[model samples]
Target: MQKLQFPAWLKAAYGRCPDAIPRGLQSETIAVEDACTRVTSEPVRACNAVPPWSVAARNGYAFRTEDTNPVPGSRPSKLNSDSDLLAPGRRIDDPRIEPLEPGTAIGMNAYGPLPVNADAVVPDDIATALDAIQYKRVLVRRLLPRGANVIQKASEYAAGDVLLQKGQRITPERQAVLIAAGVRELKVSKRPRIGVVVSSYERCAPLGSRSCWQTPDACGPYIRTLIEQWGFEVAQIEYISPPSRAGSTPQALHEAEISYRRRMIELAQRYDLIIGSGMLSTESHRRVGLNGLSWFAASSSNDEINISQGPGSRFNLAVSRDRSPPRTEKFEVKDATGRVRESHSIHHFDRATFVNLPGFLSSVTVLMHVLVRRIIDLYEFVETPGPCWEIGELARDVECDRKTNLMQWAKIVWGPRGEPLIDPLPDQEPHRVSAFLDADVIAAIPVCRGGLAAGSRIHFLRLDPMRQPAAPNCAIPQPIEIITEAHHSTEFESMQPQMNIAQSWSCLNAWLQSMPDAIPGGFRAAASDDDIHVLEAAISAKLPADFTASLKTHNGQVDQDGVCFEGESLLNIKGILSEWTCWRDVIANDEFEGITSDPDGGVKDDWYNLKWIPITRNGMGDSLCLDLDPAPGGTFGQVIRVWHDDERRERVAASFEAWLCRMVMDITGLEEQKEQKEQE
Candidate 1:
């Protein structure tokens, strides 16, 4: 073998290897219970029908639909309640079994199979006793629907249908389904074997280092543990030191590298994967000329292992030839077999001393994980043979009457029957949406050092749902509508003695007032001081006039001093109108509108002819934009342009307004508020 200096780069090693190293293994069949975590080796098929036989669908008695013959004074004989309806019954033409009146004694039976030609079998409770007849009298109250009592055979599935396929993991429900289909065994692909190579100097402690721990050995255990968790067996992890310098020749290191490579190749044949642990570079033999083999191969090749596809692709190359010493000049030597696998012209430098090995290795681990996960996904696609169980989300139209609790919100995905056939599990639905927005008395911290303890927070919950942003067609930004401004309170925001009663009253009153039409017919609002007892008394009285007068006269603003005005005040009117200017600017730029109405009645018309200045935080403190429909809906804000000079303020206002509009549209968007107009 030729003596060579190992190039000290980790990328060279990675480039020479494949990303998803192929595994050649056979498939095998296993029972469903024994196949957990195993990849499917082949697609499975159903062996039998799902519901194999006709059986009782309910606890009620089964009888022929024609049993309800309208013959009076003729009492058809009855059978024992415990007897199967399918068993031999008095024939429809039997002389002894006379037809009974509409309201006569009928035998009671549960789980009985219906007899042929019998129209119906009414339960005992439905039939009035004619002479208190015993099990001998047959009676019925109503006609039964055809095929109502029978659970037809093979209703779910048929035999010889695919149950599962190769490269798929079996889930619990899938197992049950397979069982129902009469599948006893399943074939699965062999688990991929992985060899983890941790090439690092820390693996084996050098002669001078006091730390006896080998880096490769220490890291190997952790790597193996993680790999096993991913459902793969970890092969052996060994540590190697820098080649010896005793012989002043590259022969020793060459032999070691060849030995290690050959062992790895052998292991690869048996296992799906293998990983080596040790520093691929050579900082160990600083006093000697012997370097690592990884560096040697890198030095002998001109091509770099580092490729464009992240760190993992660095493992897919041959060798690099370009260097100062020109590795080509020294590569004419032969291996122990008298043949060279690498190019003859490349010089083989010591493979030790590769910098950036640690970071590169870490990145390699991440890349490998990604590749493995991708392989799992591909396998799943190929293995799942049926209509690939999928989750479909659709908006279940709910009438306002059904909107009672959180469960109804869930029923949007689930059916109205309350059983969640496809109900989105809690916390899995679109973001965290909750009905109760906690209320608390919020107060500002006193600037004085003599700290006044802030008021205790009193949380108030409202019966509302959390709102989310909506699609473009509704003309409202958010799909969900929050009828009230019930904000989240944090300790940081409230530092003073928060008035719980006042905050609670404010929120409740605001919510009530906002939903003017939602208030009950006889309900009224009244208020006095911000006292719980006083508020409760007013609620009992249901006096709206008293509440309205008391809040303005006694409770003061009942709002955050700096909070944006939610009322129909002068500030709000001015703010909304001013915001319109900004909206117009956005519309002009985005080209969503052709003209914007200005406060001066000037239609800034022909947006197509104007150039819009792009607004960004860097260029200015804040900017406005407009979102107007090409058509009109008679809603003022819907067609209005809005603006806020402050970014935070703009975001908050826009978000809230979007929600407000959606709520309004969900309610009044359907029709004009006639009663509202009359009151106004």
Candidate 2:
């Protein structure tokens, strides 16, 4: 019944694995073009300097800087010119070309290496040619400063400079830089091989099969795909079917244990990591006679290590085999004197990391994202933690046992104040694989007594498949301050009844004018009564009093500033009407007729309700609307989100006035914070 905190468990888990790029992981030289996403095994240095010699940056005449006066309106500087002008592709060392003299100039094409002694170039537009009896003279009207219009030698990078450090992944941008630095090949770590093991008591069936009591392996293929996406190769996906007999006899259990151990040993010899999902509980381990296994015995107090996160609470981390002969590998390292020295690196291999995960699909997903992904990142030498975490406010109260950390799948919706609201999905019962279908992010709720209440700030990791690891400076968010409605009421009362919509509009407009950068495109002219009436007639919905007054003050933004609200553009009368008509058309066509709204929120059940009028857009086919027709137990005139691609509609505010009041308070509160910081 004892639980090991996640951080301590993670530390212990890391101790079992080898340092990054173990000796067993051999290095291979690959073409620079094929090095994207591969970690460098050794530091890569530039083979040659970029722009080996000074070159003209533009089509111009190259000449010495001292030969001409750089002041304006001065007599044109005269310089002797060769009969045959220098062109691109002509070698600067050609024997036919004379050395550039102080008073002589040479016509050179862009990117052409400068002739000897030429320090600057005059663009062709400012230089003219004059015919003379002895030789042609170039009369440059404007003088160019020294090194002007020239790309200096070794400006970008010098030969032997480190282009990429060890353990850095070659991104597309980095690859381009490496190619330009004359790096043709890179020594990168070989992809780590991973093995996925799914343990179950029931008979496994193929997906979509209707056979009796047969179910598909939910964690196998999904885990494989995740590992592959992270650039690791899944060598094999094997299933270990423990004896299904009730109250398994000791002999049967012993036989199952032998089979399981043999399979694990085989996988450990081949793979860098072994991920086992299902049958991680002590009872399950005992039933399979795996209680004697060293890896299973390392669990805290009990056979299972309870990580403070839910559905996936039961977990285990151990090294399958840690005793391996030290292997020595040679590496070319740069010495203090910048000379390459051959050094021997001693490391141990044959120690495959083993991670045991809970059986449920949701648990598998949570542990994979939070735990397994971290393991892969360490193995692959991923510098940044990847674009994983996003900040949002909890949409509603989430109750938990408070004994462990909770991992909840949530759908993201933008609030009226432009803050992201995390709406937890209903089907959190570990077995519901469908819970992940519509989930946008996985909210990591820290261990707390009464759980997190609505409007509490929390950070969650994104589940976006297309996201690439980036931003080395992205730090993991710290635990949030648990906020309950009762505790928040005091803070809310201090800012209430401050300003009405019309007054707030005036104050906001003044602030915007003071800070032009706040709204790049200024506010549009106020809407006329006729325009408002036209919009009402078009949408066939009456505009709320507060919304109508705000429109009269300013129709909308001139362009999408995304400043009116966090990342939304306030819609004008015409935009509102257009958006309404479009949604109405979608409804008439029955495009999403059977779809329903989120059951927990105060929004109506219909996917595209006719009574919802859009007031702002997030530029991603999602909008914040005024809900004139509210569902049962919902407030009329509430602000809600209507997503074009999702079926969730969430109520954000009680009314337009309430939303504007909060927006104003947020702006003013930020200003106050800034003022205090400046004073400090």
Candidate 3:
């Protein structure tokens, strides 16, 4: 199997941060009123045309150009020589508004549409006939322009202009634009839901029963509070206690690993990500926290952790997972002395991501912020902002011990002049906790090395990563959804919408039904219960319901000549088996490695994990499949397309049904295809 790899540069930067999380939810829509400050998960468009119909721009008198012409100001009330004037009993020929004879004027309020057959509005300022209109005589003024003082249809925008785009944060201004475009609702990313697992050295008798001895505060609550400020949903804090505290037996301690493992799995089902604290360090002899995670993955070597562990080595050991037992009876553990220490149990994890951070209140806060912030960015597939490292001049001399020890992150704060200033926080010492409490940002100094002059520009992040300016809902290349009611109605009219999914699917399916030969072999018939069970066993995963529904209709295959998707054959059960087996063998033989942590790629690492199941392949060897294992914070049952040559994967849609809808839309166009069919 190919070895999963992370770019050396990124690994260095991430420190102990894991690569990816599993997905548990999908994008959802909420009313615009409820979406302010939320990030959009998908692009939204104008539903109706702006200025649905032509209307008056301001209060004015409505009339045709010919009616505004001079007609001998002194002409008799009953008749004129030219007879181009209103002759009292004559009927107007247009149906738009109440018909009136030529020279008869119609009054219009601001923003009102002109009466039928009327092409222009003469504003009170421009009419010049306010006093002479009661009688038949008309005043002569400069010829008025047609279409004057009127708002034309589609003046602001057509029916399908994009109003909101994916990854854009909604603001009041954007809300106004959405309202104008008839967007009453929008799709937005859900907040990250976290399952926190904290390890206590000892278990308490019961909740709120501990003696009130004055001791330092626990860091868990503070971490929880800080994360909440980031707009994430924080689940109840779950504590993993040592076996002695729980049952007081060797067997109980031994069983702790299994119990916590079960808990982690259970938590995984409900949370986007799981965080374990104090597991890496010793916690009451029960292997409940980090040790349990390592054993679950059966890891063998921890090179990455060793490098990032820095100065602390006595209690630190990297745990890796292995599918088989070690060859030697004694396992080698890398130590701070640059040598291996032999031990019975090995430390390392391969699949499970674990990071060891000091439990110091300040230390934990800094690390947690970095780790959580990165994960949030990754979950939404957004650009992970980098640290704003700059040369910072220390206001005072920062000093540290000479012995190489734990990495000390000094607090940083913005100076009076908006300059970044670094403040020294005591290293691994509790008495100097004041430095942490008063600080706003943090900067790390080299382990075992510390002595700085007052003036120095040191590397640091803004506590938060540096954010680059981005255009939000400004210009979009293609509109995925549009609100037509906003565009079709007058200023007073609003479009009432149900949803867009049915319409998109109905349109695509209607076109497909029109062309019987669109799919290869005319689409296969639905599979039986026995067939579905067999297929599920063969793939080792329950198929997405929507995908299975489509398969029952066709089984994704082609036995005949004609095809639908660029001559690519949808894999039948047999074809799917063949491809799956080939991949298994390749992975077994170390010929094809799956995934480590890939966030930069549109497709996340979960697609390459064992949980993902392949569904189809193209003639080019590229495969399209379903992600059974999504990131802890990702949407499951999502479709991913993996390219043949580079193994680059791209997430296409949230579910099989959505994927099919997108496929039809992509093959044609999301809205344009339907618009065309409607036109036909």
Candidate 4:
């Protein structure tokens, strides 16, 4: 039951293949504008320098810097203006235009080539216009430096400069630069052709079929679409039908196997890569009367290899066609000196690679994202993996056998401390499609591990772009009253006194009554003194007096929708104790060891602190806590925000009382605005 490591298998399979161009991958000449996302077959060079000639950067009078000189407390220098103005599209050699003289200036428009021998320009704003009997005169108030307001020719890029390297994909920004550098055409690699074969023992209907007993062929279309998105072309998708259900006769099985083999051979010759889906497992191959490894071994003299095993690694089966006689073709290419010379390229026909993928939608998705994408990148000569990788804590334990790699899909959720928590989807069975639909990342569990425990840190590849964390909606309202430095001092003597607990609670209660929907199902009853005492003993930290008073007035929220502060709900005594104990366990186990924390505005520099008691939670691991053990310059009992996925620990208020007052103000202000709109 030993399984091969995927990386080692990939290296051994295609490692020796020359880094030279992929065999049979041809190049085509296309307009530069249409080459975005296409891989380049050869390097691209600029045909001409940007800004072919020295041009004026501003609309002003262009003249040699030596033409004018002004002394302190003396009158400005005057120069004669040329009869003809210089503008874009006007040649300097035109009969009407004259070469710039030593004491003369020419009117030049922005982006217009400078008149011959003109080295500087004084902007119109600074040049005073004077009427003269003949043409005109411009008075310069000061001496200007040479080359001022002029864009020198060839400054951006010189002709024959390499714009893009071979094997690089043309991104939109790169394309724009290439086009600007006078590159009109590009030689790009042709999209690799892919053929998909879905071989299933059960009769599956095509999409949109209404057959009551037959399931649809989901893997074929899904894989095809994914391949297309990777810049490859799916030439054909064929389905191998199962034998009659009435009986499994030897003759019927033989005919089915012959048809499947013929289709595979044809695809291998016509396509660069042939993907075989379904009947990937040994048991499934036996049931279908076709063994992939045996068939490939018998069909070709080349070595047949099992690249990897297990559900996720099954697609690593790579089979190649028989080697063919090498054929050479002559083509023309430019050398380093820009000389076009004839070149010869050798290629072997009918040498396509084959990958046997499992039939389940979940496995298909993982393989397509991780394995198939990498294969395409190889063919295209892409040097880097596309998606970003990140670290996250497991939300729950994931159990798997020690003999196989477990590829699990997980949804990323923010923990109460702004850390990323990986929530593995429940439906990982091969046939289930819901897991694929809800997954944000794919976590690859290496072989020889029985399981991963909750809170265990693991690295995962992002399936899609990470979503931005929810913004704190109930932030301190505008016309913000600036809290003085004394308010945040560690000593309470210097702190600004806040409104009494009763007054703050009254304001919050009135606002809640006005907006009944604000707290869905209303608030829970106040916590008993015994319950509060239990919470304090569990966390080994005493609650702030203001927080205790507020809880006694009305404990935590009754429902998730009752978000009271900064997109979080007030936690009851028991809820606070549970959250505190859980975080404490994670810290005690050193699960967050070596993890970095981003502290802002006097917050302590630590991932999690035992003295920070959870007061409110948003259920995704983000919480607002009362910091009893603040940093050196921070005030005690200050409220701070903790995010699960984010490293930031932001101080929200000087104290719990201050936070409560701000929330009341925000709610009351919102209500007043709503009333004003109604009045209007």
The lDDT for every candidate, in the order shown, is: 0.35, 0.69, 0.52, 0.67
Provide TM-scores for the models. Answer: 0.38, 0.55, 0.41, 0.53
Question: What is the Cα-based TM-score of model 2?
Answer: 0.55
Model 4 per-residue lDDT at 400: 64
Ranking by lDDT: 2, 4, 3, 1
Instruction: List runs of model 2 lying over 4 Å from the truth.
Output: 1-28, 51-63, 70-73, 78-118, 121-139, 203-211, 247-249, 280-304, 322-347, 380-401, 410-427, 438-441, 449-457, 463-680
Candidate 4 runs further than 4 Å off: 1-25, 51-63, 70-118, 121-142, 203-205, 208-213, 242-246, 280-282, 286-293, 296-311, 316-325, 328-347, 381-430, 438-680
- Name the best candidate (by TM-score): 2
**Candidate 3 segments whose C-alpha is farther than 4 A from its true place:** 1-18, 22-26, 36-39, 44-165, 168-182, 189-192, 202-207, 211-217, 245-252, 278-288, 298-358, 385-434, 444-455, 463-680
Model 1, 486-530: lDDT tens digits are 233333222322223334344334443533322222122332344
**In candidate 4, what are the lDDT values of residues 1-680, reduced to their tens digit?**
11112323345444422221236556899999888778788889988787666788998888887777633223456889875555434444422244687789887788877776788888765565566355488766445668989988777888898888787677777888898888999898776677887777543547544456667778888888877765567766777664444576888877866776676666667777667675545553533422343455324333333344334545434445554665667667888998987676656443666666664677677767766665665566543423334555787888866666666788888765555678877867876767778788887655556678877766566664222112211211234354544323333234454456778777666655644544446678888999888888877877889888888887877874355554567887778878888898899899999887877656787899999998888778989999998977787898888887899888877888877766665544433344458999
Better of 2 and 4 by TM-score: 2
* The best candidate in terms of lDDT: 2
Q: Which stretches of candidate 1 lie over 4 Å from their true place?
A: 1-25, 66-80, 84-140, 149-151, 165-167, 204-219, 235-248, 275-365, 375-680
